[model samples]
Target: MSIDSIADAIEADAGEPIPGLREGLEEMRAGRSGRRYTPEQLLVRSARSTLGLSQQAFADLIRTPVATLRDWEQGRFTPPGAALRLMEIAVRHPEVVRDAAA
Candidate 1:
């Protein structure tokens, strides 16, 4: 849809507060969005995002269990040595260590 179409849909939201947001959202759905990040390098969330992978996919890629990946991401447990090293690689060179399909 064009920006004008998104604008027309905006008012159709029945007086919602963020009608102007529709255009940006449409752009995002078209793969034309930008993201800002906080530099929390040691966090598992950061590692997974660096590789542009979902949590489950990142776990599978790194040969770690999903539950363990969750624990590390949620800060419930420390990442083990192997997991830590893998995350380090993700942090340093995500495109290098990450697979194309992942």
Candidate 2:
């Protein structure tokens, strides 16, 4: 929906009870609400974290530029198929990536 339509809907429902709004708010207040990440972002981040490596280190391990890794993690660009597969391997077996890096 357009921003104008969304604003109009909000104005119309100003005093109306919004379904699940209260529950969602409560979840946030309880610190249970989590930020969402795209699959590419998650994959890159997960792989890095799984290996306990910093972004630069992870990028080096993968033979990718740090800037490109950052872009992938930030969802600015999707990683190539080979990179994705390598990251998948890293996530599943971080030791392999670490050993290879050594």
Candidate 3:
């Protein structure tokens, strides 16, 4: 396809009043485009990456064990009601997690 044809196709596929196109374009042009991750998400992803740990290893670090972590990540099982509270607290203040583990 010609350049104009390709551009038009892209615009059509993007759909609906340009959506966040303007904000995305501005961020790109300014070289400051990125995403925001929650602290919990960041901590979990970082621990997995930093230690070259599998899901199992990640579970071990958080003291939840491999199978339970897998269940949590996969949504197969909800952690115990209490564990969820602890997780939220640990996500907010990871040092508390370390101290508790110690």
Q: For each candidate, give its TM-score against the true structure.
A: 0.53, 0.64, 0.44
Model 1 score (lDDT): 0.71
Candidate 2 overall lDDT versus native: 0.83
Worst 10 residues of 1 by lDDT: 34-43
Model 3, residue 28: C-alpha shift (Å):
24
Give the Cα-based TM-score of candidate 3 against the true structure: 0.44
Q: Judged by TM-score, which candidate is best?
A: 2
Residue pair clashes in candidate 3: none
Which candidate, 1 or 2, would have the higher lDDT against the true structure? 2
lDDT of 1 by residue, 2-77 (tens): 7666666775665654644766777787898665432332556878988788878887887889898887766667
Question: Where is the poorest 10-residue window by lDDT in model 3?
Answer: 38-47
**Distance (Å) between predicted and true CA of 100, model 3?**
1.5
Q: Candidate 2: deviation at residue 9, Å?
A: 29
lDDT of 2 by residue, 4-97 (tens): 4554576577966466665555576678966767987899899999998899988888888999999999888999889989889999998888
Model 1, residue 43: C-alpha shift (Å): 2.9
Error of 2 at 14 (Å): 29
True-vs-predicted CA distance for residue 72, candidate 3, Å: 1.0
Clashes of each: 0, 0, 0
